[model samples]
Every structure is written in C-alpha cells, then in structure tokens.
Target chain A: MNNLVEIVNLTKKYGSNVAVNNLTVSLPKGKIIGLLGPNGSGKTTLIKMLNGLLTPTEGTIMIDGNYVGPATKSKVAYLPDRTYLTMNQTIREILDYFQDFYADFSRERAEEMLKSLGIDPSVKMRTLSKGTKEKVQLILVMSRDASLYILDEPIAGVDPAARDYILRTIINNYNPEATVLISTHLIEDVEQVLDEVIFMRYGQLVLYTSVDNIREEKGKSVDAYFREVFAC
Target chain B: MLGKLMKYEWKNTWKAGMLMLLGIFIVTVAGCIVLQMPGGVVSNLVDGNEANAAQTWLVISSFTATLILYVIMLLASTWGMLIFLGIRFYRSMYTDEGYLSHTLPVTANQLFLSKVLVSGVWYLFIMIGIGISIVALLVSLMMGLMDISELSGVLTQYNGNVWEFLGDGIYELNRVYEEQMGMNLLHYGITLLLTYVAGPFITMITLFGALTIGQLSSKHKGLIGILAYAGLTILSSIIGSTVQSVFMFSTNIVSSAGGTGITTNWAYDINVLTSALVAAIMYGVSYYIMNRKLNLD
Candidate 1:
C-alpha cells in the first residue's frame, strides 16, 4: 500500500521541553490509525504537525508525495480538540463559510448530520451545549472530501451517546481513499475501528504497528498494549 | 479566494463600520444645520437681529461642522479599523477558531494580503465619504439654504490670492467642522485605517520573530511570545527614530540654504514622504517575516 503521510526525523520542541523527538513514521493510505499517548506524550503535537498547524523543528512531513504547504493544507481536514467555531455564528453561516473556502465541503452532508443530531443550523454556536458544538464541528470536518482527516480528541468532552455519534460520523463520512488519524486517550472506544496503532510516550514513538499484527503476535489488543507500553 | 476572504471580513465588520458611519453622518448633519440656522429664513423667524444671527450661525456652523467631521471620522475610522483587523487576526491565530482559517488552503501571504486589501479599501471609502459630505454641505450653502454668504464673501475677497490667503484654510475649515461635531473624523479616520492596513503586516513580523525567540527562550511559550513582541517593537522604534532623525537632519541642512532662498514649504512634502517611507518599511518587514519564517503551528 502507498503511504499517505511520511514524517522523517520530525522533531518539535516547546522551549526546553521536546514535544516530538526525532520521530519517523509512514502511514498508509485509506486506513484508520489511532495515535495513542499519555497526557504529555506529544499526540497533539504530532497531529498538529501533520495538519501544517505546527512546523517540525528538525525534519519534514509530507502529505502524499508533496510537502506541507497550501496545497497539502487544502487536502487535510482538521477537527481541533476544542470548539473552533465563533460563538456568534449560526451553524448555517459557518457551513456557508466552509463551502465558500473549501471546494470539497459538502453542505448537504453537513446539514443531514446536524439534523440527525437534532442540531438547529440557525442557532448561534454559543447557544449550543459543548457536546453539541463538538458534534457540529466534527460533522463539518467529516463532510469534507479531504485526503487526510486529523481529529484531535474528537470524543473527549462529549457524552457517550454523542461520542458514538461522532465515531459513526467519522466512520461513515470519511472517503475510502483517505486516511484518518485520531488522537485520543480513550483507546478502547476507537480500538475496534483502527487498522493501525501508533503508541507515543513522552514525545517519542514507542511503537508503530498494525492492529492485526499486534493482536496476532502478542495475543493482545491495542488498548491492552497501550496500558503495557505507557505503564508508569 | 481573496474575494471570499474580503467578503467575510467585510460582513463581519459591517456592523461596526456602519455604526461609525452613522455617527459621522449625524455630526455632519448637525454642523450643516447649525450653519444654515444663522442667515436663512429660520433666523428671521427667531427673535434676534437677522443679520447678526446670520453671521454668528454661519461661523459657528462652519466651525462646528469642520470640527465634528474631523473628530468623528478620526474616532470611527480608527476604532472601526482596529476592531475589525484585531478581531480577525486574533481569531485567525491563537485560537481553535483558526482551524477553518488555516485549512482554507490559502497561504499566509494570501491571508495577509486579503486583510490589507480590505483595510485599504475601507479606509479609502471613508475618506471619500467624508470628502463628499463636506462638499455636499458646501454646495447646499451655495445654493442659498444656509447663510454661507459671509464665508463665501471672505473667500471671494481673497480670490486673487485664494491659495495663499487660504494658507491651509480649506483644510482648517474641514478640521473645525470635524471638531464641532465632537469627532476628529478625518485625521483619526485616516490614521486608524492606515494603522489597520499596516498593523497586520507588523503583527505577522512580530509573530514570526516572537515564535523564533520563543523557540530559543528558556521560558514558556506565552512568555516568549510576549517578550519577542516587546523586543521587536523596541528594535523597530529605535531604528525608525534613528532613520527619522537622520532624514530630518539632512533636510534641515538643505532647507537651511532654502531658508535664505525662495523655495516655499518643501520641508512639508519631505516630512510626508518620510513618514510614508517608514510605513512602507513596516509593511515590507511584516511581509518578509511572514513569508520567510512563519511557523503556523
């Protein structure tokens, strides 16, 4: 399988502390990958670098064959951990903005997703509950036909029902030709859908292997291995 | 893409801009009303001497209008531009709100360019609006709705040497009108818009410099960003002042000779050009920093 993302000697530092240290990894196309890490394991940083939000300090990250730039950024759909939408905007307005900016954005898909969740597109973002806002953000991100979808803690703050909805949206809306990189500590909920798992510990990649390979080799699931690898 | 970005920027800022424009309009109207009250049929209806009322009202109205427009234009333009640019920039960076901004497939250059263009266009619009309003008031007075005869008589008296007698009279009149309306309408407006147009470019540079310094700092990221901005500001100020002083000194030398010669107010032109050059430098520095070392993350 062709690699969709290639990170070579990618290192990122915040002051004296290193967030991602000399990490080298290649993710295959059209697969769901779980980036599992502890509280300070650099999962967010790694994901950010992939989306061109943060520049790597020591190396390069390429999306498909091209390097990170405007072209690569256009092809990547990012859902941040927190709500990114302005509080004053309505869901419909936000969707319009998205449609205007991103040619790949699907307004119909976004509207359908929001309706399914009982979200009123006309209501201001500030009026929505946190879980609802997250779902809305997720729906918007997933509605795009992007080459890569980088979701950071997509289900972190939501209720179980909303979490399931978010997961279902991701699974159903993502294009088959695209890859999904989900960064979260809620490993068990996402373990079943992941084709590969990358375990990070203290700004370093401890393991990068497929779920099938790990389960077959060690008779353990990714969540089980996460506990073992990140055990204090 | 630029068009879309500009459209959103305009839409987001339209409310504030309209409020400001309304304020300017009110001040202008008040000044015109005051000017017309003195010499027109209204004065005759009042219990005052028609001639004296006419004279007093014209002077007062003219002064008030000029002052009000100046003040309102200044405040409205500055506040409007600042709020618009500041909010957009703040949202575009340093917040999760930037996910949409950064993911738009537009470069940092395009983003900056869009902001600059919008600011420039808005500022231009404001200038035109103020100019047209002032001219309209003057036209109304000339058409006999206001007792502007005294003012016109004064100008006509110096018609042979209008430019010299005026000695910035037109500008002064406009200023007074703006002031009376409780606004610095034009000065502040122009300054604000110019600042808005130039601010982002400066900020982009500051951000780049700050991020670089932050990376090098032993302190926290936030602290480093602050320190970097401060450092860059201080550095730029020093350089700017030094350049200004050098130019002023050189100009003084040239004008010292012209002081004894018959060369008019050439120094004023030089001063304006020098200020414009400094602003251009700031703009260039901003673009350079953003293009060269922008760390989006």
Candidate 2:
C-alpha cells in the first residue's frame, strides 16, 4: 500500500511527561483514516508534530517522500482545533491570504462552499458566531487539493446538525487521491465515514485496521467495538 | 513570500502607527494655531492690561491642561512602539494565531524577517513624526516668546540671504573645530545619524527574541514573555555599561584615582555597538527557538 505518511519511532515529550510514545504507524493514501483516541491520548500532539507545529523528542515524520518542512507543508493542509485566523480580518481577506500562500487552494471552490452556506465573504471573522467560524475554517481546509488533510477535532464541540453539515462538506469536497486524517474521540458520529480506524490509548497504539475488518471479525459495529475496547 | 508576508503584516499593523502620527500632527498644529492667535488673553495679562484677568486665568489654565494631556500621549506613543510590536509578535506567534502562522508553507526565518521589517518601518515613521512634532513645538515657542516683527527684522539683518547666515554658522563651527582637533564634527555627525537610523531595528530584534523565548512556556506565556524582555534588556544594558566603562578608562575620560576628566561622548558609541551585538545574539536565539524548540500550546 502506498503510504502518504510514514512515521518512524515517533516520540514527543513535555519535560518528564510523555505525550506520544515510541511507536510508529503508516497511513495509506486515498483513504479516510480516523485517529480515534480519548482526551490526552497523544492524538493532538501527534497531529501537531505531523503539521510541524511541535518538534519531536525523537524519530521523524515524512510526508509523501520527503521530511516535513516548507515543501511538505505546501502539500499538507492542516485545520487546527482552534480558530487560527485573525478576528480582525474579513472572510474575503482570509480567502485572499490562503490563495496567496497555498498553491493547492482553490478560491472558486471556497467561494462556492461559502455561497452554499449563505456566508458572506465581506463579513469580518469577529462578527461570526463560533459555529459559523468553525464552518468557515472547515470550508477553507476542505477546499484545498492537498496530499494530506489533517483535521484535529473538527466536530468535537458543534451540535449534531452542524456536525452533519461538517461531515457532508468533508465528504463532498474530499479529494479522492488525497489522504484524510480526522482525529477525534467521538467515534460513533465519525465511524460511518471512516475507511480505517486507529485506536490510541495513553500515547500507545492499541489497534489499526479497516472498519470492515472490525465489523467482520469482531461481529460488531466499529462504534460498539470502540466502546468495548475503550470502556472506562 | 517574504514580501507577501510583510505586506500583510503592514496592513494589520498600520492603524496603531497612523493613529499616533495623526495625534502628534493634530496636537502640534493646535499648539501652533494657539500661539499664532491674534490679541491673546495671556499677552493682555502680561502687559499689565488685565482687563479680563478671570478669563485670562481660564484660558491659560485650559491650555496648560491640554498641553499636559498632549505631552503624556506623545511620550506614551513614542515609547509604546516597542512594547506594541512585542505584543503583536506574541499574539501572532504564541496565541491561537500561531497555529496558522507555523503551518504556513513559509520558513520560520521568512516569518520573523517579515515582522521585523514591518515593525522597523512603523518605528521609523513614528520616530520621524515625533521629531517633527518637537521641532514644530520649539518653533512655536520661539515665535510666542519673540515679537514676530522683531524676528523678521533679525532675519532680514542678514540681507534675507539664508546661505549667508548658514555660512557664518559654518565659519563659527570651523573655529570650534580648529580649537578641538580631536573632535571630527563631520564624522561624529555621520555616526550619530547612523545610530539614530538603526536604533529602531536593533531594538525590534531584542523584543522578537524575547517573545520567541517566551513561546517555550506552556502557561502564562505573556507574563513569561514580559519577564524575558525585562531580563534581556537588563543584560544588554549591563553589557553596554561595562563596555562604556572600559572605553572611558582606556580613553582617559575618567582619569587615574577616579579623578573626573571627560572629553567626547564615547559612551554613546559603546552603547550603540553593544546594542547591535545584543540584537545579533537575540536574532540567533530566536532563529534556533523558532526552528527547533518551537512548542506552541
């Protein structure tokens, strides 16, 4: 299988606290992989490392074929869990910013998505509600034609209605040739859309398998299997 | 990419500097207008024609009040540029804004350079504005103190030829230069001008470095960043002071047994050199932290 991301002995620590343990995983291209882990399971830490936000204490992460840097960042579109755009900027300015920075960014696609949601590009980010801001962020991320899409908790705090809208946007705009890594612990809501699921517990990888494999061998839905495996 | 980054940085940061520039211009203009007013109440009171002494007191008191206000704002805005730029760096690099900044397809050096250049430009503008304001205020004060007709008479005393007056000033300066051969006026002027022009950029580097160091902490980053700035500034001052002491001793500005003997203002040169050195060290620290030790919360 052609892997889009290759991690080797990845480990991240904060002083004496270990965030990502000494384990490695390879995520394949052209699939929606769910990085399922509860709070503090090193999901965000690993995602941050992949996006070059944090440095690893040991090991390395390679995107496509090269080590992570400006080249890899160009191909990797990241949507951080927080609102990263300046609140003082208008949506139009942000669109211009993305278009300038990312070659893979499509202004037409982003405009279309914004139009469908009835979001005015001239409006400032400060005027928008939190849910609307998240939607705008998701639209920007999904609009990119990148090699890897890393979404950290994209649907964690939104209502079920907004969550469905988010899932639809992801599904509708997902580039078939690209890899999507959605990191969230809310497994049931995202299980149906995931092609593969990787369960993480206490910074250690518990399992990595296809969603169909979990159904066939465990004789249960991925959500039910997740509950059984991660029951606390 | 650096140009684009600088363009956006300037776009975002222009408002603060613009507000300050406008404030200085407006206040200076108001003061000049007041000074130029016809038949002012203060003049009446001063000439022993206190027909409306109460009105004169009110007018003078109000002008004093507003003068105080302008002075406070002027001082704040002049010195506030460094602090404001430091805060800007903190917000863009350490807060939620950092997530987008670090993930962009540009290198860390490009980002740092963009911010420093944009900030340096604003500092230059604000410094020029303050300088213009001070010169205007001084001219206004001179006009208020001296009778305008007499001042014009004095101006035409040199046959209205500005160059002739400038030549006389240069002749006096030449006499002084002859008496003090060690003081090269032209060279000293160039050095002074260079220091004035480069001061803002060097100051910006130190602040950016402190802010980058502050990013290492997981909590209370603002407080840590401020502490870092204070620490760095103190260390820089110590270095500058130590170099200045050495220069004074070697040049005999301070003679043996601590007997005071001073000539040129060599301390200023030592301070400028030390500041440039500190800025270089700070830039290196910031670059390393941005690339390797970058741990954003």
Candidate 3:
C-alpha cells in the first residue's frame, strides 16, 4: 500500500516544552487509524503538524509524495476538536462557502446528510446544540472528496446517539481510497471501525499497531489494552 | 476566490457596516435640517436673535459631522479588523470551525488574499460613504436649500481658501474616480477592494505575531496576545515617528539651503508618499508573518 502520510523525525515545541518529540510515523492509504492519547499526549499536536496547521520545530511531513504545504493542504480534510463554523452562517451558506473554495465538495451528500438529521440548511449554526453543531461540522468535512480526513476528537462532546450518527456519517461518506485519522479518547466506540491504532503518551507515541494484531496477539480488546497502557 | 472571501467578509460585517452608514445618513440629514432652519427660529430659541445663525449652525453641523465621520470611520475599520483578524483567524485556526476553512482545498495564500480583498472593499465603501455625505451637504447648500455660509466660514477659518480647497478636493476626487472608472465598474469596485485588503493584511500580521508570542508565553494567552499586539504597534509607531522626524529635518535643511522657508510643495508630496510607503511596508510585514508562521494548532 502507498503511504499517504509520512512524518520524519517530527518535533514540535512550545518554547522549552516539546509537544511532539522526534516522532516518526507513516500512515498507509485506505485505513482508519485511531490516534489514541490522554490529554496533552501530543495527539493534537501531531495531527496539527500533518495538516500543515503548525510548523514543526524539526523534520518534515509529506502528504502522499508532496511536502505538507499549500499543495498538500488542498488534498487533506481536517475536522478540528472545537466547532469552527461562524455562528451567524446557516448550514447551507457554509456548504456554499465550501463549494466555492473546494472543487471536490459534494453538496448533494451534505444536503442529504443534513436532511436525514432533520437539519434545515437555513438554520444558523449558533442555534444548534453542541452535538448538532458537531454533526453539521462532520457533514461538512465528510462531504469533501479529500485524500485524507483528519478528525480531531470528532465525537468528544456529544451524547451516545450523536456519536453513533457521527461515526455512521464518517463510514457512509468516506472515500474508499482515502485515509481517516481520528483522534479520540473513546477507544471502544471507534475500535470496531479503526483498522489500526497509534497510542500516544506524554507527547510520545507509546504504541502503534494494527487492532487485529493487538486482538490476535494479546487476545484482548483495544479498550482493555488502552486501559493498561494509559492507566494512571 | 478572493471575490468569494470578500463577499463573505462583507456579509459577516454587513450589520455593523449598515449601522455605521445609517448613523452617518441620519447625521447628515439632521445637519441639513438644522442648517436649513430659519436663523430667527434657532436664535430666538437659544439666544433671542437671528444674527449669525447660519454661522452658528454651520459650526455646529461641521463639528458634529466631523465627529460623526471620525466615529463611523473608526467603528467601520474596527469592525473590519475584528472580522478580518479576530473572528476569521480564530475560526480558521484554534477552533473546530477551522475544519471547514483548512479543509477547503484552498491555499493559505488564497485565504489571506480573500480576507485582504474583503477588508479593502469595506474600507473603500466607508471612505465613499463619508464622501457622499459631505457631497450631499454641499449639494443641499449649493441649491440654496440650507444656510451653509456659517459652515463655509468655519472651513475658511481652518484654511482661509474654502472655494479653492473645495475645487482642489473635487478635482482630486474626480481624478481618482476617473482612474478607477477607466477600468469599468469592475475596476472601480476593486479600488475599494484593494484598499480594504490592507486592513486584513495588517490584521494577519498582528494575529501571527500574537499567536507566536502566545505560544511562547507560559501563561496568560490573552494578555500575552495583547502585549504582542501592543509591542508591534509601538514598534511600528516608533519607526514611523523616527522616519517622519528625519524627513522633516532633512526637508528643513533643504529649505534652508535654498534660502526659503520650511514650507514647500515638494516636501509636502514627499511626506505624503513617504507615509503611504510606510503603511505599505507595515502591511507587507504583516503578510509575511501570517504566510510564514501561522500556528493553527
């Protein structure tokens, strides 16, 4: 399989404190990878670096064969942890903005998804509940036919039903050839969908292996292993 | 892309812009009415005489208009800056909303360019609005619809050549308008577009500088951002003042060498261009910072 994302000796620092410490990881195409970590474990930092949101203190990251810059950014879809939509904009307006900027944006899928959720595209984003806003954001992100979808805590702030809907949206709308890197602490919920897992701790990657490998080798679920690895 | 970006920026700030424009309109109308009021009515009500009523009204109206104009200008610019820098940057980075912004498959340069374009458009609109209000007042006065002699007197006191100044000002205005009009309505529209772009360009720099400092600081992210902004402002101001002082001193030297006074046409034009160049440089610095070191994470 072709490597979709390659990070070489990546290091990100906030003053004297290192956020991502000399990390080297490469994600293969067509896989759902869980970037698991506790708070302040550098998952967000690493994810940010991959998306070209943050400049690495050292080393390089390549998206496909291209260096992570303007060219690569065009191919990557990012869903940040917090709601990024302006409060005043309706769902339809946001979608229109997306269509304006991204040629790959699937307006049909977005409208259909919103329709299924009983979300009127004309309703302002600020009027929605937190979970609904997340859904709106998810719909927007997933509607794009991007090469890679980097979702930072996609299900972090929602109820159970919303989480399921968000997961289903990801599954339903995801392009088969693309990669999905979802960062979340809800290990069990995402474990079934995630083909591989990368566990991070204290700004370092503690373990990176296939979910199948963990299940087959340890005869234990990813949740059990996560508890063991990140147990305080 | 820039067009779209500007459209949205304008949309977002439309409420504030509209409010400012409305306020200007109301003030202009009120001024006209006040200026048109019979001298005797105002004088009898206030001081019991119609004498010097036009002058009184003009002074009051001009002062009021100037104040209103300044406030509206400041508010419009502030709104533009806030939307261009504060809301847009926050949403583009550091928030879940950035998913839409960063994932749009557009280059950062496109994003930045769009913001600058929107800001430029709005700023131009603001200047035009002010100009229109002034012209409305002038037209009303010219039609003998209002007592504008008082206002004219106040203007003369400031420069002692109201008619000449008005003529020169109108000529300059026409020249700018004609230059823009030559490009069709599209080009004329883009004049404001380019001007508005400068606001966001400056804003991006301030934001980048603030974020850089925020990342470096151990605590007080907001406070640190403020300090960073202040530092940048101070640095720019000091540089500007120093350059102005140098130019003034040098111009004085030249004037002395030519055995003339410090006032000269060449010196004035040079000063204006120098300031414009400085503003351009400041904007360039801002663009560079945002382009090179935007820390969305």
Which is the leading candidate under TM-score? 2
Model 2, stretches more than 4 Å misplaced?
B36-63, B148-158, B170-182, B253-266
Chain B TM-score of predicted candidate 3 relative to the true chain B: 0.57
Instruction: Show model 1 residue runs off by greater than 4 Å.
Output: B39-73, B128-281, B288-297
C-alpha-based local distance difference test score of model 2: 0.86
Question: What TM-score does model 1 achieve against the real structure?
Answer: 0.76
Please, what are the lDDT tens digits per residue for candidate 1 over residues B1-297? 788888987777667667666766776676566545433544444435445565666566666666767676667765565545554565565457665666678876677667666655555555556666677667655544445576677777788576766667767875674444323445545555655455444444344334434533343644665565677666666665666567556655755565332122232333334445544664565455444444444
State what share of the real interface contacts each candidate retains: 0.71, 0.92, 0.69
lDDT per residue, candidate 1, A30-66, as tens digits? 9999989899899988887777667677899889788
List, residue by residue over B152-192, the lDDT tens digit for candidate 2. 68679898888888888877885685355334465557668
Model 2 earns a TM-score of: 0.91
What is the interface root-mean-square deviation of candidate 2?
0.6
TM-score comparison, 1 vs 2, better candidate: 2
Identify the superior model by DockQ, candidate 1 or candidate 3: 1
Query: What 10-residue stretch in candidate 2 chain A is worst by lDDT?
Result: A183-192
Among the numbered candidates, top lDDT falls to: 2
Model 3 lDDT tens row, B1-297: 666766776687667656666766776776565444554444343454454666666656664775576566556655654545455544454455554555455566666566555644554566566677777766754444434587677677658776777777767875664453222333334444544445444545455445445534446654676677677667656765666567667756765586443233333334334434544664455455445554664
- Decide which is better by TM-score, 2 or 3: 2
